[model samples]
Target: MAKDKKYRKKKLGSYPLASVVFSVTLALFVMGLFGLLIITTQNLTQLIQENIEVQVFLQKNLSENEVVKITKILSSKDYVNKKAGVPQLALITKEEAAETFIAETGEDFVEFLGDNPLRDVITVKISPDFQATENLAEIKKEIGFIRGVYEVTYIENLVHSINKNVKKISYVLIGFTVILLFTVVILINNTIKLALFSQRFLIRSMQLVGATSSFIRKPFLSRASMFGLTSGVLASALLWGLLQLVSSEVEGMMELLHLEQLLILGGSLLLVGLLVGFMSTFAAIKKYMKMSLDELY
Candidate 1:
């Protein structure tokens, strides 16, 4: 009787606690990685959209007052990008345009033609929400109608291509995200279920001794919840360390990391870990409790 009781005690105490924690932490870490990728993709998209600029060519020989008036009008429009509470509008003089062209092309067209053919321009950066191709077309038409405006032009093909590629990339990322989340849930569930398998006979003995279902479940549920919470914290800490390492090693990576989104992702990982651990443990215990004594063999 003493040997049998000692063996049971050993069995109950020897549950693979380290393996369970390691498995849960690994699963949570993978999910966190996917979350970071999604956040980075969104930040990249916003950066690209914000960089899209529209060039407004002014008619040659406009008076200084007319130029000032046109700039003020463009600046006041809602379609223009605003940064630091200032409109993203800049005036490029004909001489400045000529210099830029000469520097880029390595040929002085003004000197060759004996005249500067470049027009004064006002470059306006469109807000991200208005950076779509169709919206840009409408903006160009509206601005082209203004008096003293020679033309409104931009890189139409570039914008269209970027929009098309970004759409495809977004679709791929979303699909990958869904698949990864499903995988994480399954992996975590299986890990917890297997961990509880060793406790089945112990649970059965408790049931045979007249322990209430709630009483039997309470200890297991509490431990599983703690396991999950600890795993999540460990996983999150590792992820944060990884982020810091990447940001320090890779140029421009910090620009793409969104703090608010990352915080939300970390919280979500913790919630997922806690729920999966608790539910899997409860299910496993219930299954053992319902089995006959002979089933324990």
Candidate 2:
């Protein structure tokens, strides 16, 4: 009984360095990947929100009142999710439009023409979610049906191309993450198995001395759970440190890790680390518990 207790304590104490390295490395790897996922989603959302442009070219002879009425109709579409959906209609007056053209081209062509040939154009900034050609096509058809709209100009092919590329990149990243996760699990399993190898003899000795398999396995299970908990805490700390460095120095890189949410994410990561340790330990012990004394040699 005394020998068994000493043996369990000795086993737990023997592999501190290896366990620390394994826990820290695994935590950093997973946390880095998770951070990447967060950044991608945020940047994509921003890009989508900013890139929708829908142009409504008004008829050359429309009155100012008619132009204002058309602008109101375009602004009221429910699909424009006030916040993340469709942006407000921006009215570009003919004089401002002419000035823009002059500034852009540096040509005095409008002066040569002697009249403002440009009509009032309403610019619609759609949200990224509704930037698809099909959605734009429907919007175009609806607006074109209006009496005073001469044309609705939007580049459908470009939006389609961007969406397709984003989807492909997302799929590739997802696949790589799954593969890396599996590889980490296996690596941790092997590390734990090596750490627990010395206990095989102790387990057999306990069994031979009239100890039930459950009694013999209990001490190892408890030790495993303890190791798992400790490792989980260590891993979470390492991840938190990494995040802190990024947030402080990277400047506008990881604003998502602001104080409150960062604390929550760290707490969640600690739980995850603990689970990884516990499960890996349980699995390693279960394999040994099934081994016969003859197999220990």
For each candidate, what TM-score against the reference?
Answer: 0.89, 0.75
lDDT of 1 by residue, 1-297 (tens): 999977855553235678988999999998998888888988998888888899999998899999999999999999999999899989999999888888999999988999998899999999978878889999999999889999999999999998898899899998998898889888988988887777888887777798789987888888788888899998999999999999889999978987887888889888998999899888888888888878866
Across 35-89, the per-residue lDDT of candidate 2 in tens digits comes to 5565546576566655667789999878889988888888887545355544467
Estimate the overall C-alpha local distance difference test score of candidate 2. Answer: 0.69
Off by over 4 Å in 1: 1-14, 101-113
User: What residue runs in model 2 are displaced by over 4 Å at the alpha carbon?
Assistant: 1-24, 27-31, 34-38, 84-87, 104-112, 206-252, 255-271
**TM-score of predicted model 1?**
0.89
Model 2, residue 106: C-alpha shift (Å): 4.7
